[model samples]
Target: MLSIALLGLLVVSAAASPSAIKDRTGRVVHKRTTEIVQLYAYGTNISGLPIYAGSDNLAYLATDDAASNFTAVTWTIDTTGTDAWTVSANTTAATNSSTLSSGSTFYVVTDSSSDDSFAQAGFVSDASDAPSGATTTGIVTYGPYVMILEDTDDKDTYVSEFWATQSDTDGVWTLMWNEAGTAQDNSVPVTLKTTAPVV
Candidate 1:
């Protein structure tokens, strides 16, 4: 009897491939290659005052939603810095560095030339009050989430994309961009989040 039961278990396992599954109506249901994750992006506006004179910098311009689903995420920045702008300490929640996991990556693009009238300096201000623009794209993880930063006075912008994991509480978060420049009136910071839909 024991031998017969073992043989039956093996037979069940061998016949359990994707093609073997059936719905209640006995119709075959194809399996998906990847699991679908959901995320959303929403917010008001992100702009603020400058810390320096003649400065009109933007601070903490980010997506409104805190969750999203994606396959690849990327961030680009157009600044006046001739050298590569540092993305070390600049991030959302003022914590964690701008880094991604193995199946993920990050980037920045700066003008590196001369500062224009509307061009803000550095990555971008982190203040909650300013006018700024930033973009990002990436794969959605289990707890998908992202943040972006931009300068208020600078006409340039930043873009980023990467994969994010899903989670009940927001997972490891990072800032996609940061800028520095002139000051302006105070305002509220805009948060954005995105999620993939189920197919």
Candidate 2:
């Protein structure tokens, strides 16, 4: 079976905010704007050496050279049952069960409407059916950062950076996330943290 590990999968909704306007009578009026929802393009192979992270507030897994390319990695979340949760990456017949050399790097980037203390962890690998090797990416490294989108006409600008990593002890890559639904509706927030293995 082909498997992958998802590093950082997060869904964030723009919270409601009031716009103040001055009336002729010297009174202030507050108006709410429409809420926008979006999805990420990051997926991980739990059994693979290459992990994943969130880019542009969505799921994305990309290399260092093409770090800004958000579409590099794509994944879909499935929540069929209470205990049944999984995340799958779109792979071709040729890429499936492929091998990832050591020293490979994966990055996860995101944007937010507010400066949030984003925290993530639980680095899992995907299942695999590939040939076993001797040496693996002993330990994977992850880096998280934010890119501000200031070209918009609105002042409600936000961005976030997050990342994670793992080691390929078996020298095979075929991992993915066993988490549920993608792009969640975050009505409330509690806390955030980040974790991973060192090279």
Candidate 3:
């Protein structure tokens, strides 16, 4: 499936900020102003690799130079002071799957939902079967960072970063969180790490 390596997903939102103001009676009051600004651009990872939104709507690691022309990768977030949850820019809206897949090692990206931490370990060769609501370009995103399970068989939570190996099927990668080290996929591996899309 296709994804935005150089994602041109720019989000301009009107945010509110309070500024102090003095009243005629010499009393101080807080005033508000709404302005439109660029919230964030989902850029490359610390390894300088661009991120891609898979057809499943989740974020994935992009192969180097896979999307060079793209300048910015923007992701949406709903912040409640301490926490921020990822949102899809083009999907109809949904939440993360509470139940894990039976055989799939990783959760598929879905524009219809909100995912905390997850990555697209596999890619569908066919775009028509994708759940991003449109074409493969519209993908799902997790909050702050893009991550995967700790291991193929673990499936408990996500880890920060590590080297990943490319699957023999091409476009697919085996994911894991190795606080100790990197995981292997057969004899080959696609070295990748998920990080905050903030630029």
What overall lDDT goes with each candidate model?
A: 0.28, 0.24, 0.32
User: Over the full model, what C-alpha lDDT does candidate 2 score relative to the true structure?
Assistant: 0.24
lDDT of 1 at 177: 26
Q: Model 3, residue 81: what's the lDDT?
A: 16
Which candidate number would show the highest TM-score if scored against the true structure? Answer: 3
> Taking the tens digit of each residue's C-alpha lDDT, what string does model 1 give over 1-199?
9999999998898679775787896655444323222223322222211111011121122222432221122232122222221122212322222223222112222232333222222233332222233222221222234333334463333332211112243321222222233332331222234343232
Off by more than 4 A, model 1: 1-40, 45-143, 147-178, 181-189, 196-199
- Per-candidate alpha-carbon RMSD to the true structure: 19.5, 21.0, 17.4
Per-residue lDDT of model 2, residues 45-91, tens digit only: 32111333332222223333333322222222111111111223324
Q: Count the backbone clashes (under 3 Å) in each candidate.
A: 76, 45, 15
TM-score on alpha carbons, each prediction: 0.18, 0.19, 0.29
Instruction: Give the higher-TM-score candidate: 1 or 3.
Output: 3
Worst lDDT window (10 residues) for model 2? Answer: 77-86
Judged by lDDT against the true structure, how good is candidate 3? 0.32
Sliding window of 10 residues with minimal summed lDDT for model 1: 49-58
Give, for candidate 3, the lowest lDDT window spanning 10 residues: 35-44
